[model samples]
Target: MTQDTSTRTHCPYCALQCAMHLQPGDDGTLTARPADFPTNRGGLCRKGWTSAEVLTVPDRLTRPLMRKDRNADLVEVDWDTALDHIAERLLTLRAESGPDTVSVFGSGGLTNEKSYTLGKFARLALGTSQIDYNGRFCMSSAAAGSVKAFGLDRGMPFPLTDVGTSEVVLLAGANPAETMPPMMGHLSAPTLIVIDPRRSATAQAALAGGGMHLAPRPGTDLALALGLLHAAHIGGHTDHDYVAARTTDFDRAWEHAAAWWPEHTEQVTGVPATQIRAAADLLGRAAAHRSAYILTGRGTEQHSKGTDTVSAWINLALALGLPGRQGSGYGCITGQGNGQGGREHGQKADQLPGYRKIDDPAARAHVAGVWGVDPDTLPGPGRSAFELLDALGDGGGPRAMLLFGSNPAVSAPDADHVRARIASLDFLVAADFVLSETAAMADVVLPTTQWAEESGTMTNLEGRILRRNRATAPPEGVRTDLEILSALATRLGQPAQRFPTDPDTVLAELGRASSGGAADYSGATPQRLDDGEALYWPVRAGSAPTPRLFLDSFAHPDGRARFQAVEHRPPAEDTDPDYPLLATTGRLMGHYQSGAQTRRVDELTAAEPDAYVEVHPDTAARAGLAHGQWARLTSRRGHTRARVRLTPTARLDTVFVPFHYAGEQAANNLTNPALDPTSRMPEFKVAAVRLEPDPAP
Candidate 1:
């Protein structure tokens, strides 16, 4: 395509979803230029710049592959052959083991239309309730906390521009410098307070600019938040009028906070009372002027007590009277490209389109009507992502599985066990652009179109929906996910008309399905998106896009946010004698979620050649480990070996590992599988592990 014919799209990697222009070169290569989008004003991360390289990667899947039997090798097959084989096996499995024996797993990376269609296909075609997505591991805790406190969930209710307007920005467990480098440009707040265990890139950047960094112990975010709130309450920093006017359960929440004074919290969190008080003072001053924001990310929300930890932060926001203000409130720094819209448009275990509860009678009838199905025939919520994976080989669990986009074998916590579970499945189908670790063992793998080769809508971290125009055509033999879903649904006896291959047609259905629910998107038509306008959800007809929310009230019936009385709880697997160091996992600057697509990019691979453990100098010396020395990290679940990188960034009692690599360096192999009571999130951020010097060559 010529320069003038370039298509405007967004990055396919992170939730920042920075806008960019793509021109397909005659030589089959693609060029990307930063678009002056509001979220990222004409800026792109390294990942975004190199995103096009993935489009023409030498190993990009161009044809479907299927294995004839358990011990057989995967061989290339035609689309029809692959679909028919998968359909026949699914039908046979359903007949032999019942509908509940078929499960579908999805990803947050999918476009809004694709996610909606996947959820519908699993429920209507397979008649199974065991459907969930990899997003459950990403930001479900924040979603759960938002719903509980505000009766709804949107990553950032206000626009990203508000970050620069806020007087004080308190970022909890988020390191945007490495995760979303473009976002740091918006960090113009006078006082920035970052809470994290490690001296992360974001923390260091903030520190360099005179911002404060509170290095709390790993898994102690809840206690840290409680401590901050308690200090604020004691210092009379809380807005009593705002609390009384716009919230409930204040007394109980205050009582919970009172129990954890700064001293007690210091014991639990390892953040000093003086630092807590200073943070409280800054937040209080900002709150007095109605200019503060409390934002969270996976670092604080990927724990067994993730939901409660998020709730504690929400309580602090509510106490400060942040919500309902113009530019101040609690928000989640969503990690996936479409994570906000993915969960809202369905694909979550307990949700329907429009962010409605699946078990709710109104939601059931509304969505069922949109699908032309009987409401009574619809199933209730099923097991969460990890639970479903754990049950794959069980007698009563699903026997056949269909996976889309997600690479759980590399991404899931306790991944070694998850891989074994995948191996035990009677049949498996994977639809992806590359042969991810999860796809390698699948009974069938279907080649699918990449983001730039397709047209769809993706809701970014700000809850803004933007159109992704097709910049180029996919290689022959590969098909869009919509086409694959349509063909597979038809082969499984569903009417072809019900599952159209066009993304616009699917989005139309999605809008209708989401019409009146909490995250209503009825106003977001393909025509509107095609017009190059950005729109946030709760998009009702005849109304303007909601760039900001809760100006007057929340989504709750009482028109007020709720104050959750959350208490501090230790992580499921705490550091002890055998496993004396707290091990936390996170993403690196060069890799996205699982390294499935990013690892294939030569530039990214060159930047982050391999995974390594970040060890505190004290801890490294104690273990007789030197920098670049290979070490073995052993946890209760499993162990992995990686080279040790000594740094003072890590706490003396903590070690950090990047979770991008697989095999012997897989970080998830040592993570805990304990679930958060409310969010069902795995404790990926913290686990107990011991570092041992690897054998010398």
Candidate 2:
């Protein structure tokens, strides 16, 4: 065999983003070896180790394929023809049905530069108001609350390293050990508290470390958050000085939160009064000089009350004087690689490039100047993800959809409903390396390069923008997502004049969009990121790109923070005899989201090949269940059959399922579509379900 000299790049399996050295063997085989990096410490997850094999999958789309009819097979087309048709159809859709009649969906998995470039196309060339991404179902809710309270959405506030000096860390929503292992090393603290509906790996670790784990009823996390903060207030834990100096409307916030005093919260949240007090006491018992961190993940974000629930967490953090401090505060743990970047770059329906609202006149002017377009030419903000799709099936809806790596059919809330909406569209195009569950239903499939074959930048959860290098060339025909999008925009006749042709140029443009805008990044060039220099957002001359945000003042107009004063709302789905159990979905250690790419790999597949519904041993016993037995998990939205395994992690009446499976086992199939009003995130974590024995597979 001959030695291979493939370029080295970062793994696409998880947000850990471990760098990899890919060597293509003489027989056209790709081999991946981990690069010694600070983040992964030269360690690779099962999924990362075998990610290279996904490139050689026999079923990979080798060329652009256009389907002439719903019942027809895909016909291969060259790049020019394929791109032209895609652009033409999109323009036609917009001209006839209006920009809102078509929607653009991006994925968090794309490289930061690709992510940035795609948004540029969507907003400029397309002129579509119905633009959103899969993140609306993952981490937006936590973001909404953090932004409202702390002026930024930081996963750990400072960085993963900041958690190293902490004494007690409250693990809300996130399960790092199983989902993001690199986070575990940094968050290894003396006391780790976990609050989730299911006993996830993080929750279990918290319990094992002799810390408290609060398993509230589904959709009642907001209620529990209120209870805990109210307890803090009742126990004289309110930060009166900070509140008075840096915030307004405290009186109103306190009034609303006071209603959730211990007794009332106990009834609504199902968390015991004593437990709530005990948890607060542990926090209160911490040394005044020591660090305490409150971090939330999807568990808190994917609900109708997601914003309110996260607001409750923020209220607790502010009440405890955590925000704007070194040792304590609330932070949102984002799940996507560019979850922070994707939204910041005008991809969100209502957002511009720098966390500014498109509807805001000043923000519009700044961005329009950067993009060389008129601010008044842009349409007003569009519908969020959940609202966008529901309207697709309505009378006056988008006739076309262009999905970029987002598999809403499997990953979106109410997958069954989303699939129908996709089917309803007259023209659907999917640009992805793999034929995802959603892409399988598309009218056209455009093969695009993956992370390993794309050279760009990615902004991590901490807002650190780093360079991502291409380690290997894509298959002969596959093109970068940005390249395809650009060509298609040109083909559609809405030529994006002056659009940057390379990722570096795109970043430069993105930085320009940030100048004089909220979360400015005018000086954040790709060369700086490539040189191991990451300038956090709000970059300006002599500013040093604020490493720690809100240290001096909040971003609000009055230079102060505002409390959400949120209250609890019941989970849309409730337990009943017909649906007597609760189902919670999440990621596992060996795999990334949906497992579209991960499960295809040999090593990762060997670790966890199929899905299982985890039930409490007691609940399983009563239901006459045994481990590894098939169980039918039914919910109000829908149900799927999976093997049942008894695990102590789940509380009684609640079962757990991993969302990695495609086909019938995708857990999002049963998730509720109801959304948080402010953030537009759906309830993906919890819903009512019932379990019954299945005869056989």
Best by TM-score: 1
Off by over 4 Å in 2: 1-9, 19-42, 259-264, 393-395, 495-497
Poorest 10 consecutive residues by lDDT, candidate 2: 281-290
lDDT of 1 by residue, 1-697 (tens): 5338777889998999999999777787899989998888999999999999999888888999999998999999888899999999999999998888999999999999999999999889888899999999998999999989998889899898988888889999999989999998898555689998999998888788777899988989998998999999998888899998999998988888998889998888888888899889988998898888999999999999999999999999998889878878899999999898889877998989998899999999999998999998888899899999999965358888999999999899999999999999999999988889999989999999999999999999999888988989889999988898889899999999999989888888898999988888889988788887668877887678888888889888999899998888888977778999999988888999889988999999998888899988889999999999999999998999889899977889989999999888899999999999899999998989999997745
lDDT of all predictions: 0.90, 0.77
Give me the runs in candidate 1 sitting further than 4 Å from their true place: 1-3
Residues 287-402 of candidate 2 have per-residue lDDT tens digits of: 24446778888877788888888887877777777777776666777787777777777778888887788889999888788777888977778888877777674435777888
- Where does the lowest 10-residue lDDT sum fall in candidate 1? 1-10
* Top lDDT prediction, candidate number: 1
| TM-score for each predicted model, relative to the true structure | 0.98, 0.94
